[model samples]
Target chain A: MQIARHIAEQPTTIVESYRSAARTLETYAPGPIGRVLLIGSGSSFNAGTVALPSMRAAFAGEVSVVGPQDFLRRPDTVPVRGTLAVVVSQSGASATSLEVARRAAAMGCATLVLTANAESAAAALGLPLVLMPAGDETIGPKTKGYVASVAALQAIAARFGADIADPAELAPNLEAALAAAETRAKALAPALDKVDTILVAGDGADFGTALEGSLKIAEIAGIPTAAYTIEEALHGRLHGLSERSLVLAIAADEVGRTEASTVREALAPHGIAVETVAAGPTDALPTPWCTLASTFLFQYMAVELALRRGREPDLMRYPGLTRRLAIKVDDSQ
Target chain B: MQIARHIAEQPTTIVESYRSAARTLETYAPGPIGRVLLIGSGSSFNAGTVALPSMRAAFAGEVSVVGPQDFLRRPDTVPVRGTLAVVVSQSGASATSLEVARRAAAMGCATLVLTANAESAAAALGLPLVLMPAGDETIGPKTKGYVASVAALQAIAARFGADIADPAELAPNLEAALAAAETRAKALAPALDKVDTILVAGDGADFGTALEGSLKIAEIAGIPTAAYTIEEALHGRLHGLSERSLVLAIAADEVGRTEASTVREALAPHGIAVETVAAGPTDALPTPWCTLASTFLFQYMAVELALRRGREPDLMRYPGLTRRLAIKVDDSQ
Candidate 1:
């Protein structure tokens, strides 16, 4: 129920997040940036993926996104001249992220710390801090926080003159996505309990959505899920699928639809079922906007699947998972 | 039987590849390079991954590896001034790889085409060509081609002034890895039949080995497999693990051992087993060398497991998989 509320609140959250994102971008780098290195984990990382295409389009010099752990151990070539390291940690309490900010600054790179926790240590470190609008999303698996981060990243790219549409323009699409997604998710969640494996496939920016979708099913629905680009799904990875497998093919673009259809044919012999998520015919959003809105499809399915399995959607199967792993810095610290 | 013989021939293949790799580097650059971008698909991608760390160390400016599909649609920042696009397609017949070479060259970037097929369209384009010693690997899933590509990339980095050990130095280690891996693989082959899923974990350069390991199992053993860095394996993904899950942790360095131990302990509650591949005490090979040689572990297991599963180790479940997808240029072309 709490997650359902968060999902409903995403449209409003995106508006507020956009304002903060614009201000953050100006403060982080007054001039247009030629290079940017983004670092985040889990849902935060997924948000970065949504923005990468536009960000790459804007900054013709260079732009890349890596998870926090990988960024910590990345080559010295990073934080190179004129590079801005954008740290997107909703909690702003990841140990690796804190270390990355310190190292990036020490290496003379411009840095910005984006999070909902303004008092967090990473935010208090004199780094440029931008607070996300989805404040205190107590749920273990995020919905509002996910949309808020997506809004912020897209806004920053748009601010830098990328061909990204305003996040506010997509708010209505978000609301419509949730309503349509709920009916479909409720119907599909029960059958997923019998599946041994779930494969999510997409292309380009849609690949990012597929990954987030896979992560949600595994984290909340307690299913074994894997994400691959549409092309890669046709690669050798298909040999392992069987009658017990389920595939979610994202028809976000022509490329996605064509490849997903090919993949569907390839899996015909194995009795694997593919469910395609195509954009609504009447949707106001276009291209990536409609595609990105489809994240709601996975979010709704995760919640419905969790409750169907007699599990709580808001509470994680392993409470204090991040704390126990020492990935995020302890709030008490 | 075909894949097994190829696995046994890696040490010999690597030696010849190193010779060709050295000559290729001279023909491609002939000087220390500042930036390089490597691209491949599947196994070729994995080989580029193994060589990435040292190559990054060699090129102080920038060094990155990407899949050919991603590279084809990559940001204009790629193939930047002073960048070298290293195309690692063993067959050198992938349409995507050829397209990338043309784009990179047209953008004023130096290019190298590493392949086993001298007559392949990519090599016939008259770009800097380096012949791999894999000869004609008729088998569906490659073993010698993987090691040969690795040798070529590493040799290129070393030629560009990176502190990489000679591939010849690892020949003894490869022989030992194959000998030791065979016994362990044979034992593992039968027990894997009951498993529903497998997760391979590693860190740093070992992460490259994890990807290749995951691929070999999925491609040859007909098992669903996924690979992740040790830290990433712990990030929420652990929640999806069940008793039927098998984990292979690669302890290729101190960082790997420490994180792999942490990962092993994390999966204890789920009753999941974590099998580690650690370097032998007397291994003449050092950190990444010993670690790179660990690819033999997966290669051996894939062959043995295929046989145990009543499948042919030499042929893929779908022999004309790539051809049907139209990813590779037609051999008739």
Candidate 2:
């Protein structure tokens, strides 16, 4: 499948994306960026969540991530004074993202667009575009796009803090994790395919990885899945789980270890299946690198699960499922 | 049945909660708060979401809502200095919330607790507590507690900025909405009870209402339910929706009306059921009052659906589901 191939090629694309963003940052003068607002939809939004640590470290002021739809509509929610709004979209054709860029530009924000396609609709808006160049993939369910966007954002964050890790250095760890994930997914698919629901939970920093994983599985396999902070899951979402529930937890640090164990123990009585994907040692690499590895591992699981369901990993089975995304249809007409 | 009664009495509880908070605010000195951080798990976190608009209006800096576990573990994610952290738990027994309050107080941030039970573990923390007494609700699902927390937060935000809505004035409109919602729930339950999955979507301003609604339904009816921003739902979640799926949307304004309509049209071809619960005539009252109405309406829907399934509305069907929350047990032991 095209998306699987894209997933396999992300280690290289992510490195290239970082280098490209680094070069772009040399000349990009985003003056007095008091508050950093990252705006996107779908996977881009998920990427923003994972990139928060770097963003916070780079910026002195508050950092926030929000979907483009909200920023476009309720501009008041985000303060425009001394603010920089970074708009991210893989295709650059997402109607909501374009609207957000336009609105932010009009509001006198230091607006920037991060995209792979320079000729896409969003590029034509005349906003300063930082090209990440993730290459082209016809099939949806972004893999390389998500990685490239995060890598690019990390590069932008680096401009603010010299201590930010170089994205080029993350590829080796990601490749190793990918190889390990390939084996793990093949072995787990048969058991996972039989499950009625998927609950993916991640500790604080890795919550976005859980969200993106749940989304990939849902879109690729047509599975009923939900993601939450492990803390939120313990609150009430656990009632939805049972013997047919497959719980995938991401834990990269000590707190996550505790959370993952607690989840497993609590669900053990209900006979719910549990799996943990750890990002190895947290101190061994930059936080985002570990986060990317966890994210990549989940993407492989989604691909393998789609195959187990006798569905094409690249092509979505449900019609109109991806219809409402990236493109704006004039349904009102 | 007890939860339903607790829910019905919230209009009065909400008013009293706000008045109590207002009186407490006169003596509270949370000096020079630069940022507002509200942390909780489950319904408490959702209540923080419902209060975002007011929180934003009241603070000069940023306002963020996060689960307590995340805040406690990923201390770097949130800016601590000159921050006001409002810790919320209905029972105040949530171990995660207590840890968060303790950490915030140690960090020199002014910390406050909003809870229904003063004796429920968290009150002993010695951080000044603004009691929002929601009365006794032995049921697992929270109704009055949610209403009261929002009221208290609203009162706090009012103290910070004079422009926030007056909770005292919101009671009559809430009473009117409650009378209307009881009728809507009875008519909607038979159809909803037959659904295999429930997908609740709300526009930007009302997304928290959707979250609370989804939580109520999940705990009370034991339904497999998920909530998303209307735009996020359009992105990918629609794939899992079909004839047996029920979609509840909240649209209280022009933009939301458009979004709700687009969602209905997009899903109609797939035979997915869509229901829009709009808080009529926003000009008649403050926006948060209308939002509370929509939240109450969904709570009633959950109660009616629980009755339709022949499940006790007050008792959670799944044992040990809420056990892991609030109180942390030593899993290693």
Candidate 3:
């Protein structure tokens, strides 16, 4: 599948972004930024969300992730002044995202946009634009785009003084992680195909990965899947689970592992399977690039499961329905 | 089911909270509140989230909802000093809520906690406490407590200069709304019982209603349910649908109606049932009390659907599993 190729392309994307993002940030604002508002939707949103913690640790300003509709809907709640509002749209064609950029700009905020298309409406807004080095992903569910988006945000955080690992040093690790994820996911896809529902759970950085991973599975495999922060699932969402349910836990940290094990033990009695997937190494990248590993795992699993179930992994199961909504514009990458 | 009784107790709970919440807020901070940071998890978080737009309109400063884990996990993202941090817990026993209250207080934010139990660890923090008039919800999934929590936040917004409708006036209206909701839910219960999955979608004020409603269904009905802001669902989650799927759209506002209709029309081609629930009257209450109407509908549907499916509504289908997570402390409710 082309997605497999896209998954393999993530390592180079990260390396190139580390060099380009800093130069772009410098041009946007030479002065130190205060509060950071990273905005996007779907997979784009997940990438920015996954990098939030490291971004916060890198700089003192409040780093927050906002959905395009949420930000546009709530004006009074936004901190505009001295706020660096970065709108990330991998395709640069989310209709609401362009509105967010326009609104953020009009509100006198330092609005910056990162996308693959410079000629797209969002980049045409004349805001500080950073075109991702990640090549085109012509599919509905993104694989390389997710990695590039996260790496872009991490580069921005690193520039802001976060003690991030150099992206150059992670090439071998990313390749190794991707290979391991493919093997693990291929073996697990058959079991996943038999489940009626899937719940992907994680914590901290992995929470963002879980969200993106779940979205990939839902869109690509056409499986009924949901994402949850481990704590949130524990709070209430666990009640609906049954023997037909399968849970994929992205446990990269110690706390995440504990929570994953907790869910595993709790659901085991019900004959539900909770698989803890490969958490790619977090030590050698700008942020916890382990999410990149998760990116590979979920993507591979989705493709394998879709193939086994006789579904198309590259295209959305119901494209006509999604297109009718007009969420993404014609200029979408 | 005690749940039906608890659901019936909502109107009285709303009326009582209007008096108590205001008096409590005035005592805690006689001065105007600038920025608001509402923190909680699950239903508590949903309650605060539902009130955000109204609270923002009530004052100039930012009003935002922060799930306890999200707030605590990202320390740098929080806006502390001079902010009013409202930590909500119907049971006052969310393990992370106590930590959120303590942290907010320590950070010099005007921390206020709302809970039903005066003896809760969260309430006993010696910080300003506003006990909910919600009474004892003693069950795993709350019905009346969700209504009471939303009412309390709305009262606080009213005190902050929001042009809210009097809770006294909502008494008869709420009663009428509740009766209407029960009838609607009863008829739909049989249809709902057959679905393997449910997606509760809404926008604006109804968005919060959608979330709490989904949780209620997932927890009480033992049916796997997910909630999505209509916009978010259109983004990607719409892909994971089948003939067995049911979409419950809370169309409170015009935007909500359009979105709901869109989802309905699109999904109908796939044989998925999309039911647009009643949007309670928006004119009579501060913000939109129509969500309260949705609250009743979702609660009653959850109960009736549970019974039809032979799953107990008042008790969790798997209590031992949820309790094992320790998300809620021993003193919960």
CA deviation > 4 Å runs, candidate 3: A30-32, A281-286, A331-333, B30-32, B76-79, B281-286, B331-333
Off by over 4 Å in 2: A77-81, A162-172, A280-286, A320-333, B74-82, B162-172, B280-285, B324-333
Candidate 3 lDDT at A285 equals 33
lDDT of 3 by residue, B72-111 (tens): 8765566665688889988888889989899888888888
Chain B of candidate 2 versus the native chain B: what TM-score? Answer: 0.94
Distance from true position, residue A45, model 3, in Å? 1.2
TM-score, model 1 to reference: 0.94
The residue-by-residue lDDT of candidate 2 on A1-333, one tens digit each, is: 787789889889888998999998898887887899999887888889888878888887788889877776668766788899999987887788888898899989999999877778877889888888798866757788888998899888888883667756666776776777777877888887567778888865577788788888888887777888887777888776668788888877776777678878877887988788785423355667777767776778788888887888776546544554324432110
What DockQ score does model 2 reach against the true complex?
0.54
Query: Which DockQ-derived CAPRI band holds candidate 3?
Result: medium
Chain A TM-scores, per candidate, are 0.94, 0.94, 0.94
- Candidate 3: residue B130 lDDT (0-100): 84
Scored against the true structure, residue A225 in model 2 reaches a CA lDDT of 79
lDDT of every model, 2 decimals: 0.76, 0.79, 0.79
Order candidates by TM-score, high to low: 3, 1, 2
**Weakest lDDT window of 10 consecutive positions for candidate 2 chain A:** A324-333
By lDDT, the better pick of 1 and 2 is 2
